[model samples]
Target: MLSLLPQRILRLLEFIGFSGNRRFGLSQLREGASNHSLRSILCAFTLLFYNTYVSLILGTGEGNLAEAEALLEPYQEKYPKGSIILFYSARITSLRGNLEKARARYEECISSQQEWKQIHHLCYWELMWNHSFQQEWQQAYRYADLLCRESRWSKAIYVYQKAAILSMMSAEELERTGEDLGALFRQVEGLKQRLAGKSIPMEKFAVRKSRRYKASNPVPLVIPALEMMYVWNGFSIVGKRADLTESLLVTIEKVEQQLQNDPNPTEYHPDDSCLVQMLKGLCLKYLGRFLQAELCFSEVLSSEGRIRYDHYLVPFTLYELGLLQKQQGDFIKATTYIERAKTNYKDYSMESRLHFRIHAALNSLKGSPVSTP
Candidate 1:
């Protein structure tokens, strides 16, 4: 159990940046102290140190860097064998743009946690992070392959996606490398098959409604209409705009009316509202009502506090807003929105069709080059 202490500590560390580390450390100390006898003071102290270390790893508010460092300093002194502390310490260094130190710490983590399957995911993430920073696709691909072999499916998918992204990063690289663009398509197809035997339905409104309790507010019709807009975006990306135009426009109009009619429409849900606004903006943009499209994007930007992490619409809105600004010849404002989109893209878990549009718009801006594969 003491050996598993490091992993537990690391998990806590990941959350500390978002939630304070001291509070988390104190809580763990209380729990462990309460359960163990007086002679177990050493164990209690170890747990406390572990928890504190985790808090440092997770906490990421403004001006907390010194506090994070102070929290870790004691652990380095108290538990010299706790190499996981070093791994997390390196993450902070990486966040500060100290790439060499971060690379070394991750390498140490890989060496120490070689036999731990669960920890392999973290190792892969670290490797991917390092390779991504250095733009070393071959190394990244190898690490990704190792992750897939180790049964870290989600991380593997991300690695493969990153590979595709790097290939798309530069046309010269793509042409010289002779990379297969179909790799991503093949991986997605394989994932679909692996998931096929399982009954994981796409997360449409009906599926969500059926899974929830009867009194749990049923999915509003507009929610599905918004999802249809995402479908429209996908088709539009694949040059199937004609297939989605009529239905997508009609659905958007219906959703807009529904939003106006319902005194408390579920569209107020941040995720749903963002999607609705984004789709509305897309429709208006395509219809050549640039001003109305800008309004929709502005509405989304203004509602940042209500933004949901799961919704891709926020970044989509930012990207669209960038395009709209670019069209209006507001280069500086366009760049700002595009940069916001790029930052948000780090958190986006899935590759969507709308990204191509964002990339195209960005390429037209000065200092923003589109990578084609």
Candidate 2:
């Protein structure tokens, strides 16, 4: 508690892109959690949140699930009905790819409280992703729709998510939704919210993607739901489940084939296809098709000059390629590419998020000069 009292200061440091200060914040929380005082429990909770939730979103989705579980195990038994504990517990399970257990825990988390609907919203959000990982489109849509109707955290994201989920369904399945996908995407711009006098990075990304819907004759987004999932680093988590990754790969391949045969091309064609290719690389990397994965990532880099709308794609592909190179025993190449990604980009969609991943990659490469893998 005392250690985390200055957490807002630490967060401000991270928000401004200070990597060292974020490390210091985590260090202090670790020391605090080592103690046996009353606030030690609070410190543990803070650390657990950082490891289980914040790190996954802001870093590489490479959270320390083991440490998170060790911190929460005792308190979880002590306060089984504690909303925040249940939340972190569920998150740990989800990160470990235990969706069924996570779903039950998230349900318990929701039913544990009625006063703080915000807590319920968090669970709903996780539940949405849980179903999404399993390709349960309608179920995911149910949670996303609930968020769109009730949550005020980020209405643009919620509404966009609702529409994205609908996009994943069969026409007969989608006919039941009765919601206009284009109109919902268009609604994103109007529903966007600002934070701390600045536009939220993710909301801005969503609004930008939704811009096509505003065109006189809109071109449907190719697997926009998967695109958003990639932004959140969801692929890293889902990659652990072969079934999930294969399902996502199938969806992406469908778009890839469509793009190849697209007779009516737009200015954004290369950019769109490159985006799909990057996602395919991610899926392929997890599926152990490393050479094919490298090809997909290189295709994005090869077409970088042609990309118009999504400038972020190049740097992100570089980062992904760097990680793959790191895995293939090429430390110098990995370090060089990851550093280029870190230094050569700014203000793109989820740029900061990708920076954190690049930072993690660079750090590991520095620690393993001979290549860890």
Candidate 3:
């Protein structure tokens, strides 16, 4: 909760039009209100709500579930129909492992708004997570499909990964019931094939990949953590796309310096190196250095056995190459690269990525050489 004094300070600053500074601050006022005025009361209410929303978002990001929930509870009371508040509250609940309460809140959010399709998809995702926790394979698969239909790529990837695990569990259950294991294996293989050739957008994949790596590797945490902090400061200085390019260059330089100073170069993980190269490639692409980006991406793709697990790096690189080719009006090469990405997505359960590749392929086929940035 925001203190009354802080609220008064903010009001005074607003009154004096002292909103130039981006950093959060409190300024002493000349006089404090002895009696409540309508304007003062409204200002206080606005400040309270603004503080609560910011606290809830930051709390969730920091994994502070208790604080997030406490901040959201009052908003839920004051504005019962606010679906955004309910969604955040439910997210916090889900994070805290209270699936039943989370489900109730999500359901309420869905019921509160019919126009917001994203909320509906979110509710289904929550349900899918709950079902997965209980090892209910069939129910989980159904909800997963629903989520995929809604273009919830990250959550959809999670669902398909769970489905693969569940398939193995189901195989054991079926064996006890005298069912054929070979047939089950064949079915699983077929599903994998279907999901193989797709790719997710590079930007979205980078964000997810960074978070995943952050859990295990401390190196990649620096850039993303700094980016998060930049956002926290209201994106005041680094809000522009141009700022992102500068930041990316800085990060690439830092990574390069680290690599140069390392004694055992071969001992360094290929994934980490590939990630750095990929970031450089993305920055080049953003700066309209198409050929350079192409070379960087190509080098990463050609490097053998760099990634141990299923990663979207290859497909993402291929997709970007296609975009570059399209920009250069090389429709033939663009089509080939995008088609390759699509094939990879089909093999990798990256349906969302495949969707973008398909659009690119379609444009190429139609002889439309100009591509959207």
Candidate topping lDDT:
2
Taking the tens digit of each residue's C-alpha lDDT, what string does model 1 give over 122-208? 766666645544445567655655665666445324433444434423457655556554343234333432355652223222233
Candidate 3 lDDT tens digits, 209-228: 33332333333222332222
Write one digit per residue (lDDT tens) for candidate 2, span 131-243.
99888999999999999889888999898888888888888998888888889999999988877899888899889988999999987777878888888889988998998
* Strongest candidate by TM-score: 2
Clashing pairs in 2: none
lDDT of 1 at 231: 37
Clashes of 3: 19
Would you estimate the TM-scores of all the predictions? 0.39, 0.91, 0.38
lDDT of each: 0.52, 0.85, 0.51
Per-candidate total of colliding backbone pairs: 7, 0, 19
Q: What is the C-alpha local distance difference test score of candidate 1?
A: 0.52
Stretches > 4 Å off in candidate 1: 1-63, 78-81, 134-139, 153-156, 169-179, 192-311, 315-373
- Model 2 has how many clashing residue pairs? 0
